[model samples]
Target chain A: MTTRERTDVRRLPEKQVRDVAVLHAILDGALQAAVGFQVDGQPFVLPMACAREGDDLLLHGSTGSRLMRTLAAGAPVCVSVTHLDGLVYARSAFESSMRYRSATILGTAVLVPDDEKLHALEVLTEHLLPGRWAELRAPRAKELAATSVLRVALEEWSVKVSDGFPDDPDEDLDEPVWAGVVPMRVSYDDPVDAPDLAPDRPVPPHVRALLDRS
Target chain B: MTTRERTDVRRLPEKQVRDVAVLHAILDGALQAAVGFQVDGQPFVLPMACAREGDDLLLHGSTGSRLMRTLAAGAPVCVSVTHLDGLVYARSAFESSMRYRSATILGTAVLVPDDEKLHALEVLTEHLLPGRWAELRAPRAKELAATSVLRVALEEWSVKVSDGFPDDPDEDLDEPVWAGVVPMRVSYDDPVDAPDLAPDRPVPPHVRALLDRS
Candidate 1:
């Protein structure tokens, strides 16, 4: 599949993936993104909480911020999400690399209308905290007013996956060094109660569910 | 201390950090960064292996990549490094957030000249793989030729940290919901040997050192 000039992974074209499912998989498993936008010909990239809803990727931002204002006004943005899966240790420094699943989406973000803002908020909150959204109180009107939800259609994007073992050349194979992948993953530590929390409050099952993942 | 207009953390001025040591600490502990650069006003953010050497942040890229080529020509770039430390579960979804250490550096990236490319390469490799650099064979000239090392001065940078407990309002305190942080950390799984490796090869001490860290 031919991608537009912008979404093309020109550096390692072989690693570029055109599959929509792959793109969704990367987005579905991600909660954060480094969003890039240009201001006065200079690029600024900042971390933002994100969620994918239907065909659009939802990004939560402060309405007062420049990036959010620019994005809400339809400036082009690049959202990047990456999962560093492992470290590939080859026999030579040149051949050593990382195993990762990376996705980049390019689109202008449309501001969620005032009426849809509440639903967008639920998606954003639920996407990050899952079941906790149900037990939480509704967002205050003031809180909703301060939040900005920007949705970028997932129409133009690219995904790159590099998950193989060290691909050292044949000449470097006999170098008598161990070659492999040191797999990496994110895990949750025990939930720590807030300092002011009442002593009687037990940790919620929803939060405990985070640690249940093997 | 006043920061450059570009480096100002305008979104939440209170979260901006000025200490150079804090900036270095964020960079030192980080290996992956989302580097943002522009072409014809369209911003692009790509993940790259990074290392901080003294006052400069070194980013590794393929010579043929558009980002590298643009940076090599002294185009402005923004490099963002973030460690998502934990999930903050507040009583209200509006107050929930994440604990993170995020740094943003904005500057023009200068291409490391040919004479210093090897040293830059070492910093990049050693920063990511640490002791593996000393154990690996040297990078061949062709390999060196294909890699581009761009250095962005840490001069124009801002670090924002959000590591505290969820700051729910006083009125929301009695909501009878568990509120706290679910800490997150990255850990390595046992190393998996390359399929082509000899069965008798043992994992190196340097690689095992990775797992030894607390």
Candidate 2:
């Protein structure tokens, strides 16, 4: 675990450095994250498809992206992942809240070295579609040249989680209010096989497995 | 609409602004959002239940919060909402991307005046669980005093969205690759009625409707 200062403790109350397993679970659960940073004194945030590769996160963009260029210049960046578990219906409107788990990482991003970019790309690819990497063609040199990838180390981070029932106000507990949780989840629907897919080419096992869980 | 200067786009790309409707839809559809800001040179991000109230977003926090104070003091802030539409499987590992719609609002948040706090709270409650304000007990004076609500005007905002198929490199298009979209959605499970509820007290129609859609 990495040790870094967490300056704002009130909004971000839980500052415990999460273990690697916890961090991985949070990253794996959310397929996308909001990446926030300041470019020329203006705050800019862009959501990108991301995957965790060892101790860093792989974020990709077109080579001409201003976001990529700003990050490459060693500007500070913040990446946030959130999962809404349930809606907390409290006895009073003021006490209503959501049960959720979120992780925020603040760090400087470095452009991935060419030698390691391919592997990072593979991590992202497999993360998006398991078993598809081996079936797909590799990137040509020029195509790879046109893309830029950055790895932001997850060093200074915090995870704030709120779970279970709503914290109803004492006076409103017996006010004839119906209060409970409405569970929220993310799930996949049946895959729509590609229109161009050959009739004989069956859907791959990895893709089929997702539907089975549903 | 409130014509605040912060809502005015300074360096915003014209093409991106034309897609503003898509951004509004993304924010409306997102179940959760990460609110980010800096306090004394340190960064913090918190996942909060949010709702769009007119042209602004309503975010609730504890009245005694250090973060709310920082925000009310005119510190820079970023609120981001994202919906992961699908996982885009591509012909090459480098071309794999996720179909998503995201909006980031950059501005300083203003604390909702005490007189207007109740209306803001109602907007949040109604947004999370429709008809919840009427179903549940209203906040007492002290409870209302104990909570703080702020609104971040969505004036200076940008929405980035990508949908449909992956933009894979041309050379990899026919390489025996299975490329398509794995659609994702956020859903609500059946609401759990409170254990102490009276048998005659039926679940409200608003709550019951979300069950079948789940």
Candidate with the greatest lDDT versus the true structure: 1
The residue-by-residue lDDT of candidate 2 on B66-106, one tens digit each, is 66777777777888787777777766666667666667788
For model 1, the interface Cα RMSD in angstroms equals 0.9
Ten-residue segment with the worst summed lDDT in candidate 2 chain A?
Answer: A1-10
Question: What is the Cα-based lDDT of residue A131 in candidate 1?
Answer: 87
Model 1 CA deviation exceeding 4 Å by range: A1-3, B1-3
Cα lDDT, model 1, residue A205: 82
lDDT of 1: 0.89
Clashes (candidate 1): 0
Tell me the fnat of candidate 1.
Answer: 0.88
RMSD to true structure for each model, in Å: 1.8, 3.9
Question: All candidates' TM-scores?
Answer: 0.97, 0.88
lDDT of each: 0.89, 0.72
* Segments in model 2 whose C-alpha atoms lie over 4 Å from true places: A1-20, A195-199, B1-20, B40-43, B168-170, B194-201
